[model samples]
Target: MHVGVDVGGTKVLAVELTGAGADVAVARSAQVPMPGRTAADAEVEAAVARAVADVADGRPLAGVGVSAAGLVDREGRRVRFAAHLPWRDAPVRDRLAERIGVPVVLDNDANCAARAELDAGALRGVDFALLITVGTGIGGAVVVDGHVVRGANGMAGEFGHVQVVPDGLPCECGLRGCWEQYCSGRALERVTRVALGSHLDGPEVAALARAGDPVALEAFATVGTWLGVGAAGLVSALDPERVVIGGGVSAVGDLLLEPARRALGGALQGTSHRDLPTLVPTRFGPEAGAVGAALLAAAGD
Candidate 1:
C-alpha cells in the first residue's frame, strides 16, 4: 500500500491506496490536528509521524510521500521553512522514513497539487502549463514535458513572491506588493474584513459572494483583477498554453475567473497576435495535494 500525507498548517491529511490503477480507490483516510503555532519542531514532526502511522495501519507499505506546506529541497528530503509550522531547515523526509519504516519522499504542497493536476487533473495533455494555487498565499508551479521546473535552489515554484506592486502591501516573505498578497485566500479574508468593520471568515465570505451580495461580489472582483494581472505577467514571461487557478479560493468559480480572463487580454505582451491562454479550474480541487503526494511515493523518485 502506498501512503500520501499532506502536512498543512492546522491539520495533517493522509490517504492510503492499494492496487493502484484507473480503478484505484482510497483504502483508508485520516486527518489529525497538527501541532499548534506554539508547539516545538519536534512536536510537529511527531504529529505528522502519528498521522502517517494511523493511515499505514501496520501494513507493508510501498512508500510514503508527503506534500508539505513549505519550501523543500529538490530531493524532497529537507524542509527549509514553514511559516505556520515550527520547522526550519529540518530533515523531515528522513524522520518520517525512520518512523514509518518506508522510503519516504517530500515536496511542497503546491508542487504536489500541481503534479496531481499534471498527471491526472488539469494540464493533463498540455505541453506547457502554469499552476497558481491561492490559499494562505499563492503557490505556483511551471511544468514542461511532464516535469516540474525545480530551480537551482528548490525555490522555482514560489510564484507568490513575485513583486507586482512597487510599494504595495507588506507580505510575510518580507516583500511588498507580492502577487499573493493581492490574489490569495488570505487576501480575500483581508478584503472581506475591510469591507465590513466586523470580520467574516473564509466560508462566510464565499457564502455572501455566492448569494450575490454586492459587497462580496465587489471583493471577489477586486481580487480577481489582481489574479489576472499576475497571470498576464506570467503569460508574457512563460507563454504557457494553459493556466490553472486553484486552491480554496477557486470555489468562487466565474466570479473570480471571468474578471481574470477579461483583465488578462489587455495586459498580454502582444495582445493582437498571441492567443489568449486557456484558464481553467483544477480538476482535483482540494484533494490534489494528497493524491499527488501518494502518486509520487508510489513512483519512489
Candidate 2:
C-alpha cells in the first residue's frame, strides 16, 4: 500500500491506497497545534510522521507523497515559502523521507488538487484546464496535456498573488493588491462586513444574497467581478481550455459565476476572436485535496 499525506496549516490527513489509486484500504488523520515557541516545521513534520505511522501499521509501503501548501521549489522537494506555515528554504521531502524511511515526493497542494480533479473529479478527460481554488486564499494549478506546469521556480500557477487592483487591500503576503484580497472566501467575508456592517460567513452571505439582500448581493457581485478580472489575467497568460473554480465560496453557484462570466467576457483582450474557456464550479468540492494526494501517492508506485 502507498501512503498519501495532505499537510495543512491546522490538520494532516493521511490515506492508504491500493490498486493504482482506485481502491482505499485505511485512512487516518491528526492535527498539529500552532507552534508556541518552536518552529511550526518541526510540529508539522511530527504530525505527518505520526499520521503515516498510524496508517502504515507495519505493512511494507510503496512510497509516500505529500501535498503541501506553499511555493515548492523547482525540484518539487523543498518548500521555498508558505504564507501560513513556517517553512523557508526547507528540504521537506528529504527530511520526511529520512524520518519515515521511504522515498517521498512533494508538490504544491493546488497542483495535487488539480491532478486529482483531472484523474477522478471535474476535469476528467480534459486535456488542458486551470484549477482555481478560492478558499481562505486563492490558489491555482495549471495542467497541460495531463501534466502540471511547474514553472522555473515551481510557483507558476500562483494566481492568488496576481495584482488585480493597484494599491488596493493589504495582503498577508506583504502585497497591497493581491487577487486573493478580493476573490477569496476571506475576501467575501471582508466585503460582507464592509457592506452590511456585520460579519457573515460564506454560507450566510450566500443565503442573504439569495434572499435578495441588496448589500449581500452587491458584495457577491464585487467579488465576482474581481474573480473575473484575475481570471482574465490567467486566461491571457495560460489560455487554458477550461477554468475550474473550486473552494468553499463556490457554493454560491451562479450568484458568483454570472458576474465573473460577464467580467471575464468584458476583460478579455480580444473578446470576439478567442474561445472563452468554460468557467464552472468544482465538482470535487472539499475532498479534492485528499483525493489528489492519494492519486499522487499511487502514481509513485
RMSD of each: 1.7, 2.9
- Model 2 misplaced regions, further than 4 Å: 17-39, 54-60, 207-214
Q: TM-score of each candidate? A: 0.94, 0.87
Which residue pairs of candidate 2 clash? none
lDDT of 1 by residue, 1-301 (tens): 7888888888988887655444444567888998876788778778777877898787777788899888898777799988888778989988878877778989988888887787777777788889888877888888877678888878777889899999999998888999999998888888988988778877788899999999888888988899999999988888889999888888888998988898888688677877888989987677778877998888877
Candidate number of the best lDDT: 1
- Candidate 1 wrong stretches, greater than 4 Å: 18-27
Candidate 2, which ten residues in sequence have the lowest lDDT sum? 17-26
Evaluate model 1: give its TM-score: 0.94
Candidate 2 steric clashes: 0
List, residue by residue over 1-301, the lDDT tens digit for candidate 2. Answer: 6677877665677776444332333355434443432466777788788878877787887778888878889887799888777878999999998988888889888888888778766787888889898888998899889788899889978889888789998998898999999998888999899877888998888899999999888888999998888888888888888899887787888889889999999999877888999998876566566557767767772
Q: Which ten residues in a row have the lowest lDDT in candidate 1?
A: 17-26
Could you say which candidate leads in TM-score? 1
The clash count of every prediction, one per candidate, is: 0, 0
